[model samples]
Target: DVKVTQSSRYLVKRTGEKVFLECVQDMDHENMFWYRQDPGLGLRLIYFSYDVKMKEKGDIPEGYSVSREKKERFSLILESASTNQTSMYLCASSLVSFVMNTEAFFGQGTRLTVV
Candidate 1:
């Protein structure tokens, strides 16, 4: 199976703690994205990487950051955890191009709670 999956399904962090959410994709996809899912806000992009060591800030990148040192792995970092940052984080991968972008494959959601 061409897989995109998170390493962690649940995490708990205290305020001011740093958190890392890990994901790996085996499809050799060129694009990977991080998004957060909230009850009212749905899914909002936090960051995306189009290639290794290259990344772009997404709609909600203020408190979050990402790393893509390798093609198959993408890591999301929360510099300092906060109660408001508690939410479901999702990782997605897609093979994309100007001509035709393919459907995104998503990992199992990670539920993060900060207290």
Candidate 2:
């Protein structure tokens, strides 16, 4: 079955520390994404990569960055963790699509707490 796997289910970090959240996909998908979810802000995209070694900054990329060194793996990095950054982080993988109709598979998610 197709799936996205997160290296950690949860994380806790002190303010100003650097944090890394890893993701891996079993399916050989060409597109991968990282998002941060908050109550009102909804699922805001942090970063996405369409191909290996190629990345695009998403809606809210100010404090986050992504690495797509391999086709099946994507990593999200918090430059300097802050309490405001505490949220549920999600990783997703999908096939490249020309048409609008396409499906994305998501990881279970990693909840990060910045204190």
Candidate 3:
């Protein structure tokens, strides 16, 4: 079965702490993404990498960064955590389909709270 593994199911950090959220996929998908879900705003993309060593900023990438050093792993970095950054972070991966973008398989999600 295709799988995406997130390092933590829940995380708590203080303001100004540097936080790292790790994700690994066993399916070798070409596209991986990090998104944050909040109460009213819905899911807002933070970062995405389509290939190793490549990354693109998404809608809400201000306080975040990402790394894709290998094909199966993607890491999201919160440079400095803040109260407003608390949310459910979801990691997802999908194939680079020729017809259209394939459906993404998501991890269980990491709930983060910044105090």
Regions more than 4 Å wrong, model 3 = 98-101
lDDT of 1 at 81: 92
- Worst lDDT run of 10 residues, candidate 2, spans 93-102
TM-score of 3: 0.95
* Model 3 lDDT, full chain set: 0.94
Candidate 1 accuracy as lDDT: 0.93
Model 2 ranges off by over 4 Å: 98-101
lDDT of candidate 1 over 1-115, digit per residue (tens)? 6799899999999999999999999999999999999998899999999999999999989998899999999999999999999999999998866357468889998999999
Relative to the unseen true structure, what is the C-alpha lDDT of residue 51 in candidate 2, on a scale of 0 to 100? 99
lDDT for model 2, please.
0.93
Q: Give candidate 1's error at residue 84 in angstroms.
A: 0.6
TM-score of each: 0.95, 0.95, 0.95
Model 3, 1-115: lDDT tens digits are 8999999999999999999999999998999999999989888899999999999999989989998999999999999999999899999999976368469899999999999
> lDDT score, residue 109, model 3?
98
Candidate 1 positional error at 56, Å = 0.3
Q: Which has the greatest lDDT? A: 3
